[model samples]
Target: MSEVAIIGAGYYGFKPITDEVSFREGTFLAAMRAYEQCNIDPRKDVDSFIACEEDFNVGIAISNEFAVDQLGGVLKPVSTVTSESLIGLASGYMLIKSGLCDIVVVEAHSKASNLVSPEKILEFAMDPVYERFLNFHPNYLASLEARNYMEKRGISNDDLALIIKKNKENGLLNPRASYSITVDLEAVKKSEKIFDPLSEYDIAQYTDAFVVVVLASKEKAEKLSNKPVWIEGLYWCSESSLTPLRGFSTNALELAAQKVYDRTNLNPKYIDFFEIDDRFSYRELMHIEALKVSNKDTIKKDLREGRFSKEGDRIVNASGGYLATGVPLDAGGLARVYEAFLQLRNEAGQMQLKNANRCLIASWRGIPTSTYAVCALSNGA
Candidate 1:
């Protein structure tokens, strides 16, 4: 297979909601910026485009159409992948590997501002035959999983608070992050409870945002820029769609991680930086265990020891992750990939890791769904 590289990445979103630009406009702005940063003219350089989106989130039947005009995708081969943003990115990579396209643009965005009730949207994701009959709130499902993780792994709510506080503090250094606040364990413990053990702060905040990334074939990447982060390996997996039938604590991320590891010939210890979907505080801990970066029982312990701090050897979520950085739904996964590109290219500014070479990015859909995608990225293509 041919190697694909990320030539440039760009993101656009206000700290909070912004009225200055519409959702499609925000996507275009980011897309244009990324193409320009890579020194590629969209009209001439891009061979195809992949957009990640869902219907209810964008308040439109065909969300991709809203972005096509500004993304320079009109009259170009453009398709919408109704899954996680990184899944769309994985498709773009495969497109290049197939020798079909040399330059592909992947875009994803979320206007959380438009959703009157995101819970309603999430409810639609539940299984209509069995699970939806319970009429349980989405948080209830996440809470059930959290409970199982704690019971089996001996993780405490205090440990979850630490993760929340740490990610929020890390966000303070990230200018693009929406919720950059300083919260201590006590504050997190005292925050209003959303679920039994999960507090409001323990969950990611909804925000309006967009992210765009440009990928090129190895040959094209080498000629366009002196620095390009190679797509070492990419893997995605989905477990039983029926959540009740599967182990709540068993995430598909482990399978995805194993696949990437085998394909890239890399290990968890070799990873210099990482960005994992942390829509819930417990998810950070859950994914850390699934990725095998640390033992399931010791993840919270390692987190408190600062093993995953941005300044630490194994930097995790240096971009503040979805928790502190704001969850833009479909856009959240690409946001993580964009961070990997920046850190690998030495363009992450204050959040940059020292001497970073290899990075891993993992993304997951919300609970009741086992969809996941993991990718390995390196400085060498």
Candidate 2:
């Protein structure tokens, strides 16, 4: 049984830069669309409002302070989550399950263009005494992990190139894929190498986007929308932040996946689609393993056999993923969730997958941090 259902979702700007609106304005636009679709006023119907973002990313302390007015949460309960937006989704679910709120709103976005060097903020998230003092590029963490996974999984340059080729090409079918292009495998392999084992094409760039979701109790959701994507299970986990304490793969993502699977009494074999994190090219494959859907031993076959493609058996990352859409900062996970929601509701136009009813989603908190969240969703069964 589902205690929470996503009744509405709204989004804006999947481009490298969104110069038109300030973060607050963009968020307001998205909230307006969401509230309109659900036919609810945030100030009246919403019991609480949650905003997901990091303080440093917004250049403001108490990230949600400036957002309450735009979200219509004036003089009402509003909280800010400094974690990934997917965790905010979990927070909303708990709010409903705990009988605290019937209707909750979640907002997350990114204005990467505002930061002269977003990587600097990532450094702050690292161990200040050890990793931060090294003063090396934060991406070194991704490169190290990629290199280790490559060696351990026997993944070659060609394998990573294939993922780039598939996702970028898939982006061509998605309207929000700002970075989407039809690059060939040879072109991907020829791209400049930024870090050993990780090339320019292998890293997903940042973009601006604000995503808002409206969650309600089961009965309320049915009344709000003809189709509501029910949250079957949701869980989040964190691993050690220290470099040495981390593993070659995202064990936290896997743990969260396992827990969600247990909670729902379901696994990958029973799901229809997936939208795991692909902020880094290899992270997608690594997450696949962690989700227990596929692994290093079997992924190469899955990729080559089109098992993860739109026509494939699994149909993963159908929204073009971060590889094509660019990273949407904290909203990255919610973006995936929203895409899956669209598919489940038959609202995903060209990118829609036929008969798609169930989706498994996982999101990692980008590089240097191991926080992860996974959720199981169905087309309101």
Candidate 3:
């Protein structure tokens, strides 16, 4: 199979609400920026299109129908992935490697503000017979995991606060980080608790965003882009959706990371930085342990000592991650990838890490589902 490289990318609508633009318009704006960046005519150059979204997310039964023309994919081989964005990227890569397309456009967005009760929608993803009867949102599950993880890993509320403090401060440097604000550990520690150990601010907020990325085969990439970020490997994994069956102490994210590492022959130490799941503060620590970057025993010290910061030995969530940037639903993985792409190419302006050449990104489908996708990228052809 041919290697796939991201040649052009664009992002738009990283806000709490985008009242002026509809979802389709948001996607179109991102698409336009991507086209302009790579100097490609979408209609003529894009051989296929993939839009990552869910029916409930767009508030329309058949959301992909409305997304077709706005993406300049009319009469083209356009399809939708109800899963997260990484899957869409994988699908696009498959299309190109199968000799079906040279250039594939992949898009994902979040119109989270439009949902009347986003929690209710998330609730619907649960098994109605067993889980939905609780009538509480999935945050309860997160709180359960947080409490369980803390007990097993010996992590504390203060440690989680440090993670929040560092990431939020990092967000201050990110233009797209809507939730980025000045915060201190004491302030986070004192915040009101949403669910026991989990606080009201511990959860990552939602934002409106549409991110589009252009992928081309190696041959096309070399001809089209002077700075193409190649996808070294990508894979996603999931535990059973049954919340009762899941072990709160461990998650599928670690399994996903191992698979990607095995596929790419790379690990945490080799990558310059990471953009792992941080929708919940504890999840960041959990994922780190699962990824084998560091364990819970020493991660707190590593985090406090700035090992994961920009000036630290290894950089993590340099884009402020989902905590600061606002989780963009299915777009979450691509959002991280977009940031990695910018950093690898030295285009991430204020948030750019000096001389970062390779990056790893992992995304988790929010609660009630243990699905996670891991991808490794490099500037090398």
**Candidate 1: deviation at residue 180, Å?**
1.4
- Residue by residue across 140-216, what tens digits does model 2's lDDT show? 88888889888887888888887887788888988789999988777777877787788979888999999999999
Q: What TM-score would each prediction reach against the true structure?
A: 0.96, 0.97, 0.97
lDDT of 1: 0.84
lDDT of each: 0.84, 0.88, 0.88
How many clashes show up per model?
0, 0, 0
**TM-score, prediction 1:** 0.96
Off by over 4 Å in 2: none
Q: Write the per-residue lDDT of candidate 1 for residues 1-381, one digit (tens) a residue.
A: 678999988878834575789887898889889988889988878999999988888889987677677788888999989999999999999999999999999999888877888887888888889778877778888888888887887888888877787788888878878787888777777777768778788888887878999999989998987898899999999998887888684458899999999988899998888899888988888888889898866676688798888756667787888777888887778888888888888888888778778899999887757999999999973
Q: Which residue runs does candidate 1 get wrong by more than 4 Å?
A: none
Provide the lowest-lDDT 10-residue window in model 1: 10-19
The true-versus-predicted C-alpha distance at residue 283 of model 3, in Å, is: 0.3
Model 3, residue 207: displacement in angstroms? 0.3
User: TM-score for model 2?
Assistant: 0.97
